[model samples]
Target: ASFRGVLTNGGRGGGGGGGALLRRSSSIRELPRRFSRQLSRRRSSLAESLPDTPAGWAASTAVLSSFALGYELRLQRSLTAPPLVFSQSNPRNDALRETLSRRRPGGRKGILTRDIKPSLWVGTRGTLSSAAAYALPHFGRKRRGECELNARLNFREVMTMGRDGASVGIDWEVPPEKYDSSLCRRKTSEERQSEILEGPIRKPVVLILHGINNDASFGYVRSLMRACTDRGWIAAGYNFRGCGGVPLTTPRGYTGSYTGDIRDAVQQICDRTASPSVPVFLVGNSLGANLITKYLGEEGYSGTLPPNVAGGVSLGNPLHIHSGNMSFPWAQVLGLGVRKSLFLTRDKWSQMTCRNFRAAFLKALLVCQTIGSVDDTLAPYLIRNDPVYPFAVTVGYPDAGEQYWDDASSYKYVQHVSVPLLKVTAQDDFLVYGSSLRKMSHCLECPNVTVVKTRCGGHLGWQESPPEEQREGEGRGFGTSSWADAAAADFIEAIIESRRKSDKEEEAIKKAREEEVEAEVAAARRRRKEEEREGGGRGDDDDDDDAGNAHMERRSTSEREGYIAARVAAAAAARREADEIRSRL
Candidate 1:
């Protein structure tokens, strides 16, 4: 009945069409025709079912969302998160690759490694992870008190040279058993005190920089110190100006934008150590991470970081301050923290000679609701009026909060960093913006910079779940230590080991070259002696020949030394010239 209806419709359309349809219908008896008709119907059905419009896409998404909860539950049950490592393709990264490989057996661990799984409770949420990792450790009185006591008893405050009229404080952690009375200095008449080391620090010196408004007194800093000490390395926390119980001598206080203090600190550490080969590694946490990144970038761009600096590690750095300040709820929360820190040090503002400045500072503390607002309210006035560190109007020092944030942003300068740097950030770091992180991965053009973006680590919080072996122990639990600490330690240790290996290889090559030169000198002398013996008769000519040959040998040795020296000097000069050109360009 359906075939007769189709034929009637075709016959009504045209005269020959109905005859052609009849012929085709007869051919439908064949297997190929039947199969083709079925295939055409299936494709037509698929084409109708699939989405090709925005509305259709939304409908399809809604259909998927119905079972998303079930999928999420299954995902939670089988969680295996690893960090995403980003680095440029260049020959300079071979050492970094080898370092990573050494840390993990077999080949270098990639983005799929399951070693850095986040705590199940925290999952990959930024706020939860951060709060748990940073706050949970100090919840109990016993734990908190112990950390505070350790900070008080072990860390010795040493003043180092900084900007004019102000000095930077360094809290050096020395165990109670190793404490020497001679190392501690009483208050002297001099405003700035110099740090004197007994001898070169043979092991690596890890200089830790604490976050904003925090100092060596913080529990995390104490933990870091312990970690460094456990590795038999010297640990010191760099207290920003007016931090670490150090009162501000100058009216100006420490700001995150200042790189001068870090440079001065590195210079002092190197000079006091007296050993050029001593390794100094910088590890900055939270705000300190941003500061260290900026400092390293500036130094790397200028080609001025000292030879003693092995590398640097930045933990939970807020790369873009302006963008971060604009983020919801978190920005206001961070601002309140900063305001509280200022409130704690409210007495320091008494030194301001201008009544208006002091009043503005107090007002800003009271009224500012966000970090951006606080900076906008006070930074301009502070920078313009500071006596010790003068910023000329023409020099383009940031006068507005936005300008200051842009200048202070580490991402702006990260591309220029030429040294080995490990940037560890988590997807859950509320202080960092998603856009800023994406920009960071793109901006890191230098091969020396290795970025580790983990699935879940809150700001300065990299707490991992305990392994099976440690889970059963009495003292073992979560929040005991951070994966970041171990990673940073491994990175620094790997660099040190690589450096030692390189030095040994260089020494071996130098020795071989010296031996080759000595052999050549011996052969020349032997040839000359044989020539002297072959020339019979003890005559004046023979004596003159011997004297001339001796003179030639002396001249040859001096010429060789001069040639080598000239080559070295030329190489140095060329390097300086290249640096100047690069800087100018």
Candidate 2:
């Protein structure tokens, strides 16, 4: 019988007897058909409402799955407890209200502001389940599926020679069409040549560094590049040696602690832009973050930091590599799909092999179940055997203790970083332990470093909100904007703004000092002129006195001569004897 008929009979008089009759008429087989039809109609309506695209379908599936999970969890919770009674004055409700009302402490001053809260979808709950629900769908296959929806990006490959004489590939993303037409594009080869001869345009640049075995072409990295371009920044990504799908010129590959490639890359970028005055920022994900932080600390400590690098933003960077390696097994178990995706870079592994290297390569492929195992197995052959390994050892991991974790850790160098550093990580990041991250709390003592720890962005995944919850200005690009991307962009902008304000203040002070110095010089000139004039008048008076004295001396001399002649005549006889006696005396 139809549900309508059963409900109609159940509502009739005779109470229990009417309900029993209604139940007896309602057959399970009939119910299934009726429900199937109803579900089919609803599905058809949903299909029509959704966009006819893969992203839309994936999004719809994710939304439905999330709702279903939430419903199931709620059902389970309800089954284990008494039925909830809705009330205005429930103490539990009041406590929940209070908890929701309390605001989290925002980012401090400088590069980050705590005021920039995560979207409601992200910040609403801090549970691992909620985090997985949001992260898995958006960051999972959905991101890869939606790659075509992203804004058009122009990429040019530039070959930079690494410190070890290896040719490194840097996929430099040209500015978006809007900025390219206005600020970046050159009209002719002659113009480009002239600009190179003179200097490239002075535009703010953002350098994007991808995760281990990943290149600039990855969807997440592209999203970050898009974010930078959207803000009118010249963004580029440095593909570590063989990771760019290009064969390396040398036998060596990039390592976590080796910063030589990064230094060379930064120099090339600065030189290409011809704008050392323009601010440059580093944005790194996961292993990339480790490398960047290590570089920053080491260079900062050695006082070899490039003058153009203004600040850095690290997302899902495992500071403690040893701990990160230890968690790899767990991450593999929890995110097997993500782990499997890591092996897609067979090109990199293929480049690391030789006649003797095949054994190690096969070993890494077969025995390495986690990223850490791969690192351990491959490092001895691919990295340590390189000719530059000795030099790297001298500069990077000099001690036995440091080499235990492949010297990939960044904790020792954290304190030495002087520039503004924004380190963002999700609480439920499977690869990085909370304890390991907690050890980095000492970095907070350094005023330039800001750590934004969210409850949920998994690993390098900062997924966007579902369609219904998404708000305007909350996200940008192919799908919902990632909170990490937003935070990094905001921090970079803040650093740039701070630098601008600082530059303006310095200019103002310099101008004021110059004006003051000029005023002093002018006053000194005026005083010198007045003194010269007064000295001239005094000289004139002295000349007049000298003339008068000369005239008096002449008159006195004439009178003395006359008196002497008369006296000499009278005393001539007596003077003769006196003169002789005086002469003898």
The per-model lDDT (C-alpha) reads 0.66, 0.59
Write candidate 1's Cα lDDT for 78-195 as tens digits. 5446677777777556666656644253333522244665555564455766665444423211222234323322445556544454677887754222224646653321211222
lDDT for each residue of candidate 2 in 71-146, tens digit (9 for 90 to 100): 7555433322111111133443333223323432252222122222322333333343223333332232222212
TM for every model, in the order presented, reads 0.70, 0.61
Per-residue error for 7 in candidate 2, Å, reads 58
Q: Name the best candidate (by TM-score).
A: 1
Error of 2 at 98 (Å): 26
Top candidate on lDDT is: 1
The residue pairs that clash in candidate 2, if any, are: 106-114, 107-114
Angstrom error at residue 510, model 1: 1.5
Which residues of candidate 2, in runs, are more than 4 Å off? Answer: 1-153, 176-199, 323-325, 328-359, 382-406, 466-479, 537-585
